[model samples]
Target: MKNHFKIYISFLILFGLTSCSKLLEEVPKSQVNKDQFYQNEAQCIAGLNGCYDNLTDIFTHNLFKINEGSSDLAFWALDDADASFAISPANPGVGDIIWTAAYHGVMVCNATIVGINKSPVAEGRKKSLVAEAVTLRALYYYVLTSMFGDVPFYTKEVANFDDLEEITKLGRMPASDTRNYLIKDLAEYAPALPQIKTSLIVGNRVSASLAYILIAKMAMWEKKYDVALPALQKIMGIYGSLQSYKLVDILFRNKNIEESILEVQFAWSATGIRKTTLVAAITTPPRTANTSIYDGVEILELGDKANPSTSITPSDHLIDIFNKYPNDIREKIVMARDYNDKWFNRPSRDNFEGKPWMGPKFWAIQMDNKLDGNNQKVFRYADALLMAAECYNEIGNEAEALRYINMTKIRANIPILEVYPGKQSFFEELMDERGRELMGEYGRKWDLVRWGIFYDSINNTIATENEKIKANLRPYHEFYPIPDEEVFRSKGVLTNDAYKQ
Candidate 1:
């Protein structure tokens, strides 16, 4: 129980502060109520825990469906709306879940920040606590503006009925403006946080390392390489040696490894107190027997629940790229053609169907009740290194860029490139490298969108069997539509103009 005590508190905070209805419309029903909470350091810290709790909600099964399953790395084998690019404002598929959760996170972070400021905690302690909340708020906003452009942005806590009314009338803020605000805000407050490894405490807490990475990521989205380079360099100074991290075959198998800068913490509990993740259940092919190639691996009939007709699988396009570089160690780690001693779409190993399931990197060895305690890696030092390489390449320093890219290539035991392609070509290779290294971890869709090639990328998959993706994808789909419920609640303040025909 001692091991799960923090998990329990985070779960409590998750249910207490977040609402599925209109954002900030309901009064919290948990032990920590905003009306009479945060009187001391303990209460302030609890409030901040609520802010961290929201991260679990944001990086959920739905996010996986939209972010990775819809991208080139993986695909929904079934005719899922998101997989087929059939998402819309009215029928948002999983977009509504992601949209609602991100905004709820922002609201919880805002309330926590305000409560911490008003609390009587020591000045130094208060500053650090508030920095955590602010950093978390920036993350929520980043997800918001990334997924749904021009979201209804707000920083004020909805403390009273009047404040709630004002929130209802708020209009959508430009995504650029929101990113700029968060970049500047994090720059000022993130330094106040002590330099601690986020791998501590199961990688659930915010630290300066994660903060700088977030700053660099958002800046990269806006093409502000100058701002991004320094932020990435800050992380490089701390973790550049690459001695502590590795290209481990199965990353999430051990939670909070040194490679992880941030992870969405999950735990297994019989009572199901928001302690488990649906990742393995959704990603792997469903099975009922224990015929796994590895000893003591238990298979479950859980993978097809999210899409009952079919399971999520690695795309042929991804496999083709992996085959392009046979020496790439990540190929077997990221995908497998056999499961339960039987090849995918085949009765047994002797029969050959080339379909591949998501590899052991994502499987939960002994998943319980169709769920597992796999902590989702939200940020890792490997990605930071790649981003550093990208920033350097963008800033016309090809030598520095190759140095960082080679770090990953060497770790994977793959041959490193000595010749630098020109800037544009180098970026294209970086894109594929990111897909190769970070496939299952969220960011594929966002990467395509950031590179202005989402529509083209999805269309390219049509040469294989992604006809639905090509037919349904639109230019404006670079940004997902806002949930209709949110627009309705905003009473026209939040218009889905980009999605309008």
Candidate 2:
């Protein structure tokens, strides 16, 4: 299914039916034109495929910088803007990349929704397809508000070049309002979406399970646990027993395993047509194609497709957390100071400044050059369980919280969190448990922000290596500033007041 979707996406791009990145700044009108397209079911499917295009790009380097790099789990290996927490509105690092990608995604999704609605497809199919576009648009807004706080929110499509004027004039809306709107939108679409277990379908497309998870996630960001808890339990009920899920070497090693809820699909093709990315290259240690030996150890090569850009690496705090639990099974899969029973002493900052390489969870064993085809796991059942535990703890259901948290711990073969003196203590431990379980994945920074501990957590970070982050991090640095170019382009309609100089 992933390969099938990738091929369809490639075809859409070739036909100019897919939206490009410039849609963020310019009109979303493609060369094929929406008027001529979406006349049938196949065309509507192609339009939906375009919406998934940017999702593949979202988890790449800069967003990784915003999501995990700025957080305690990892940091930019160099003195990059985000690593030093000196990302001004002027400089385009994390903010520009994520902002552009997310807005482009939103625009494409809006176009898809509008096109699908008017298409000649059958009623039921049109509803389901539009439901997907709505969910995907919600996802883009989710990224926007999560990273930028409030952004210019609009659901209407840019029907023509003239609409660009109205689009630019739009001002930032409250993140909470955007989130609440999306929560309701997803609810309306939930019934139209299929109830198939995402794992059974390998999470190739949006299902009710994915929609619920997104709803829960966005609701939690607003601290609306009353809205979030039921959505999470909906997933728990859908997926069924924790016994069916386990912590294994399945993350990137085996894409779209049974534990997966949604994965951004990627496929490697000898013809270079398959949708692939350099995520594995960015995450893995820098190495050459073949015969890459270092310090008497054969540094396992991540193939010759992409240059291993060691942009992001694990922080000392994350390393210590894994070390704190030597008996834990996840350490071998998550990170390693050594590989193949030998120290990965690569003499470059790309390889964690010769510290540790991200473990098998990210390594693309069959990568062709820099084109690692591993599907980036966006949402997994394990994450759903952890989120449920957080929601339960927030609602004062300690017993249920412990039950959910223990599911992962029990799978990891670590000690179960059997007891806690109070809700805060349990919540704190659950935070660490989430860290240990989902170390290199995205949303760690968002976790700190939503928990209202972003400032304290980074300031209290004991890692001497990240002192620069602590020094430069201000209270207002929680959400990145809207890019100066974007603010300027909006003709003062948009402002990053928190970053006004």
Global local distance difference test of model 2: 0.75
* Most lDDT-accurate candidate: 2
Question: Weakest 10 consecutive residues, lDDT, candidate 1?
Answer: 1-10
Tell me the tens digit of each residue's lDDT in model 1 across 145-203: 88987877889875544666787788888889999999999998888886766766433
Alpha-carbon RMSD to native, per candidate:
5.0, 5.1
Model 1 bad stretches (over 4 Å): 1-35, 201-203, 271-274, 289-309, 338-353
RMSD of 2: 5.1
- Compared with the true structure, all predictions reach lDDT values of 0.74, 0.75
Residue 452 lDDT in candidate 1: 85
